[model samples]
Target: MQSTISYLWHTDDLLGQGATASVYKARNKKSGEVVAVKVFNTASYMRPREVQGPGRQKVLVMEYCSSGSLLSVLESPEHAFGLPEDEFLVVLHCVVAGMNHLRENGIVHRDIKPGNIMRLVGEEGQSIYKLTDFGAARELDDDEKFVSVYGTEEYLHPDMYERAVLRKPQQKAFGVTVDLWSIGVTLYHAATGSLPFIPFGGPRRNKEIMYRITTEKPAGAIAGTQKRENGPLEWSYTLPITCQLSVGLQSQLVPILANILEVEQAKCWGFDQFFAETSDILQRVVVHVFSLSQAVLHHVYIHAHNTIAIFLEAVYEQTSVAPRHQEYLFEGHPCVLEPSLSAQHIAHTTASSPLTLFSMASETPKGLTFRDPALDIPKFVPKVDLQGDYNTAKGMLGAGYQSLRLARTLLDGQELMLRGLHWVVEVLQTTCRRTLEVTRMALLFLSSSLGTDRFSHVAGRPEIKELKEASELRSRLRTLAEVLSRCSQNITETQKSLSGLSSELLKNRDQVHEDRSIRQIQCCLDKMYLIYKQFKKSRIRPGLGYNEEQIHKLDKVNFSHLAKRLLQVFQEERVQNYQAALVMHGQRMRMVHETRNHLRLVGCSVAACNTEAQGAQESLSKILDWLSHQLLQDMTKGVQTSPPPTDPYPNPEPTDLVLHMQELCKEMKVLALDLQDNNHVIERLSRVPTAPDV
Candidate 1:
């Protein structure tokens, strides 16, 4: 059956078919890229009936391997027997690398045999080997162990065979080391063209092979021959007719196989130990370092078997410099180590001398400063004062409300300014808290680092003395923060009280306005009634005589309608007044709250500054006393040239403290001015004339 999956890949050439799945060569219609797709036969596998349905078959898509499996290559007469040492080494390295990656991800490829390894042809006609068929791969849990026997019989570890035979409940479980045993068997087959452990008995061969694997030791030599060496006869495996390999290659293979085929699992060499033992097969490279002035410092050695990216990492760790900031030079010419470059290729090309590396910042001292021409200098924007904005809003609102257009303009402008002020207050509060945190940390660090004796010598210096004075300034800042905090609290409380007062005032205003509207309506109705009565009286006289009762009834109905209409208009006016009052009260309350938050933030800043100042003051006092004692000792030793006439231990007045108080007073004066201005505005508002009584 043929089908297209994901509307991108179409199944075409059939690759192979297995018991559980069928492999097909698929191609991407849009990209024209080829891939190997394995479609699992759900019927063959034991799955739940509910999961077994048409179009629900499991499928896996993978990158296509141009060359077929290693087993196919090994079985072929032309290539199977006579593999060169270098080609064999390449295959071994690739498989080991793949296994290392699996181990890193906590996976075990239990069936690591020749059938599962595939070769791919590169653009340059180079062969690259890759591990495939993860059907037997298992992800191990932290405490998990494998007990059941799985994988091909010949490649299985002796422990697994033993466990399967004994069928004991208390048998110890195996781990990823079993896979290493399978690798040993695969490598031996690839090198010698035969299985190390051959089966014998027809029906009971499986158990017989397991017994030999458990009891017998691996052959010590590679020639597959038995010879008398010294006192005992040693058995060895010789390469088959087509399996012509180098003595060096055979020597390397023998020890690795012996280690992996060890009876004890703990004695088996792991991936890390294997890699370390075989690292000499990989290439190497050298990196050199030089300063901006072309002065050489040191050189570093790195492996040239990986990509250029990996080499760059080694460079960074060696020099303690970031890769981005390093500039590589080869033979006085700049060279960029692109990601695509092969580490082995670069290492071969690099001269006997190391490649020079210089930091980007190094060029600045060589009079080669370069700035980005595209960047423009930024211009500073001046901050807008909320007080000024408030004044402008108040001025606009005070402009006569006779014109509806002007009234709307004033309201919108006032709202915009209020929003800006609210945002500014929030930012200020955050800044104050951050500043306090920084100051506290600095004071703690200084207190911990400097001793009492050290403080005296340090404080004696002019620069240090200036810093001490600055600490006093910080005390003033602290006081300012406290004042601001108090002001904020006061403003918040005042705003709450004012909000209640405004609500009450609004209710009173609404009642008065409603009463006046009703009174005006009643007066108008009374006048209309008088006019109707006159008209009726005139119609009743002499020649114009009419029904007086009818006229009276008509007048009553007209008055009733007029009264109803007037009441409705009055109620609408009352609603409008109530809404306007609420809007004004809400705006005023927000303003007060914003101001309160700003003051609170300023208070936090002051408190932090005060704490820092207190720490500095105590430190300075101790220093001064120490200095005085030191001076007295010098005088007793006749070391004094000219001294002050005052007592040696005279008390020095704290001028810094006095100055701090003065600064606080100055800030208080500014606050007082603002309060006075607010008081004037309140008085003006109070003087506005009220509506006359109905």
Candidate 2:
């Protein structure tokens, strides 16, 4: 599969396009078999040397399935969103069998969306549905909670669904349970022919579904016949899997399948167990379903596993090589160190290579680097804006997480407490900084056109006083951000104090110091958690504020607001800067028209003099030429322009026109000066251009 592009894969035809990547049909020049190739559009790995992550260079590839996704086949009008009992079993059996193949190779398909599962067409008859889009799939290692939320919306499992909404990356300790959740979602989707948790409707439906995944119970839709007493207001569906699937396949898949989709994640089956039962039923269901050949099924399994293994290995390899003192090594196994280093260093460093025993050190290593002192250490590195009222919020949160971990260790022994606290100050302080950065990043993201939808919440009650409370809405977020900032500052200060005291305590070996440190860490943690809860609650946006009456009363206004926000996003400052000179040029042209009209309106015949007329004509003509050139420049450079009829004004004032022209001239001068300053900044930031040293 890796050696050649199969015939089924054609780059010209698009198989799919999603928020983060695009898939195309492409054929291997050497292989006649068809295949699907997905090229990720994420920039995480695409940044220049300073920013690139592992796999940034690799283009994801998959085999082409002729049958499209099982999702499309089931949802198409021919089926009307529900497959016949017999046929549904066939599909289930095939999918499980395919999944079994993947598990055998230690691969878990993280994203089991219907769109990702495809069918292969055969010359003689109908095709076998093959799973594709292995981009999110990963190999099974040690049992660990999964991190990183990546998947299609309609098919996301509860865990990923929750994390994505919260915009938090899960710890890498994730295991096969993620795959099971996806499988459950896929099966549920197949049965109902609709998304699992979300009701198809307004735009906010997605966010609501995400929130539910995080904080709410499983809706009746996926919960089956055990209806929630809360009743009709809640969205629920019966157990579509048991009802729609055949008895044989159901019996085979039910055990592990139930575990995969368990409401309680801890109960879910891992990849190994899921594979065994699935492999046992492959033969029985393959013929009844698509009559898929054993060789192809095996190929799918082998290929998926190998792909995951290679990719994961690649990620680990790249991360392990990062500067040990500065990098967090993300969420994977900490690298094995050579025996030469101290046991403590070995436990800490992510370096994978082993060293000889002679290299071990008894105390702090001389060559090891410290955090940059110039950056004020923790003060500058926090994810939250520490300057705000919530400055200590993040520190409090860090202390909280540390305190929780410290509970087990502190109870273990007094010596252990001392050892752990010594490390805790360093680790927690660092973590606090990173968390601050992440939180600040999230806020920046939120500030940048990330939120604003109010209709999704109030579709049924737009005129509700709460729904129309814009000031209230802004206040909620503003208060949350402020709270977060304050908490972050407190945390930072506490961390700084901890760091300063650590040297003295460690040197003196004081028992009292150890106890105080533990208490401080615990207190900080409690505060951080409180702030986080507040932040999470603030996520309930303007969309959910409306009741049925308000929705009906102010639907138009809500929609208008939504539209305005949408337009304003495109009209943001960065975009404006990109086309600033051109926009100014156009404004100047309008001013020329205004100036001519103003003179005409007045008795003064400014153009009556030949010199005046020539000057006015030349000035207007030069400005026009500049406007045309600027537009051309923007188009050639891929800068954005307003759409046709997007002009801000149709009838500008004559005086306003003259004023705009003058403003344009002033703006051009300022722009030139700014450009010069930018050039200097760029030069300062860049490495000096130098000849190679001999």
Candidate 3:
């Protein structure tokens, strides 16, 4: 038998069980790899007659998670305090990500609860939660109605409950919104360590809980007291006061719960709406801290409109340091803390390490330099201009321009500004890459929405043309991202090389002419730095600032004209079924863009190294050639003249010559390697796709 087939998998240690399947801990004997095996119970009548082997059994194998389920953690007495706000949000984020994935694939996981959420321990000891149990999962076809009433009772949507209670021959079908409702319930349970509407005690407790879920409002939603919205329903349930959640969090949570748990399916929160709301709330409610000193640290509960002035006040309250005295440095440069500037705006601008804040009051320089905070904010906030001409296509164009500008900055001869520019580029590249993924997802969603009959009114030839254009733009932007990523990597390698050379030069300061090489390399690095700064000033800062302002303005302008145009398009009858093609094209573009950028920066440092190598090669060649001539002269003298007691070329002895030759050889080898590396870098740069003209 094959090793895979012969490998004994021990499945006796049971982990957990549900109505449909039993999970057991197992280990592969051959590989010693641990796994979880879930065996589904199949009735004799349901078993397929064609399945004659062990494969006939309904079983699924998956990776084992040591931390177990979220339900287990919540129920455990050790975790009575429940998860911290950050940890809880992380869990919710993971679940949301999974749900988003499911929704994208046109599948609905009817059961989304704490028990179904498993935590996997990473190598760093950090826990990553994953959604499991697809037993109640179903794929919905276009125009197909979902009518099944299968799911956990406590977590079921009010719509589902109504359908179940009515017992009609045919009821209104549920959509992907039901899954979101389940998530809301799961989040509530995770946060409070107890179900929201489920009542305790009484003979018919299950029925009562169902009734409360279907009919009653959330306890937090009541105007004055933690009671039902309509009237005080007689139930033996006590709200868990142990949650100790912040007012800001509670405010966000209440509305989210209300939206999800709405009785009308039409009123229920969609995936996109839920994601945006939750993401915003999570960002605001979270307290981010900046460690000024070991003894002095400042923390602020972030809000949408939090300004630099507010942050400084929070810090001053913590450390008794005034705003003027509190100089914030990020990556060794002073951070601008403008009173009118919003924290979110700064975050978008400084994509590198936006949260990182270093106080430089004690070690302040003679003249404190303050950067304009407005310079950092993007001119176009895409979210704000949702209904404008500055759509996804325009956004990509802007991103591409920024990337190209960054690449140009790296190559520019600005030694003093390179360091800061390099830092900015690194941050920008990371942020852009992440944003690209989100853009891809959005494109997918847009394609899906436009393809269906729901948008048939506007799905005309012009709209199809626009969609196609967007797809192509997305492709171009992805390519630009790749190029930028590769360029960033190359820059890193070049920096490392420069650092090594600098260190070597520092150690050999007394060596003849070594000081000159050191100065040259330093000059080269300075130029690179200057180039980076110029890039930031000319490209990054202006682009971001302009974009932010434009977006802000567009956001404020009533997009009534744009809305009218869309409405007009929708009314047109010449619309084509081009959505499917557009979607496929987008998917293909996404796949292609996954390829990493191979563009490399041909820095002045590489050029300096090449010059140094050439000089060394020439010098080495002369020394070797001179040594050969001396040896040849000595051999001729021995043959023609009487042998002298003293050796020829004795001022620098033969032993010394050999040692010098060895040293020269070593120097030449180092030079050769440097030249080879430079060649490789140049080759990479040559292969980079040319940037589109701005």
TM-score of each: 0.36, 0.35, 0.40
**Clash list (residue pairs), candidate 1:** 81-242, 222-237, 223-237, 223-238, 224-236, 224-237, 224-238, 478-606, 481-603
Candidate 1 C-alpha lDDT tens digits along 1-694: 4546541433457676765677888776667788887777854354333223345555667778878877766654323233444567778888888987888898887767777788888899877889987766678643467765555556677776665554434567888788887888787777754566554432134564444544466534322221222222233554443344533344445677777766677778776777665554433334444322222233344566577777676666655456666555444344667766777655333212345454433211121111211121111123322233222222221111111222222233232223322322333333334433433443343333321222332333463354476446445544544543454455455445545544554554444434444344455445544534454344434432247535544544454355444444333543344345335534543443444444344434444444444444444444444444554555467674444456565433334333333443343344334334433433432232110000
Candidate that beats the other on TM-score, 2 or 3, i.e. the better one: 3
Q: What are the lDDT figures for the candidates, one per model?
A: 0.49, 0.42, 0.48
Q: Candidate 3: deviation at residue 66, Å? A: 1.4
lDDT of 3 by residue, 1-694 (tens): 1123423344457789875567877767767788777666654224233221245444566778889999987764323334655577778778878877887788888888888899988899777999987756778633456766766666777667655544445557878788877887787777765566644442135554455544566433411122433444443222233453433355566677767766566667777888888777666634343332211122355676788677667656654556665544355344555778876654332222333332323321111111221122123333433333233222222222222222222122111122222232343243334333333332332233223222122223262343344334334434433443444455455345435433442342223222132233233333333332333333323234667656444433323223223223322310111222223323322222222222122323333334443444445445444544554565557644433357453245444544554554454455445445554554444332221110
lDDT of 1: 0.49
TM-score of candidate 3 on Cα atoms, chains taken together: 0.40
Worst lDDT run of 10 residues, candidate 2, spans 290-299
Q: Give the best candidate by TM-score.
A: 3
* Runs off by more than 4 Å, candidate 1: 7-12, 29-32, 42-56, 141-144, 161-170, 201-207, 218-242, 283-694
The window of 10 residues in a row where model 3 has the poorest summed lDDT is 364-373
Off by over 4 Å in 2: 1-12, 30-34, 42-57, 123-126, 168-172, 199-206, 213-221, 224-237, 240-258, 271-694
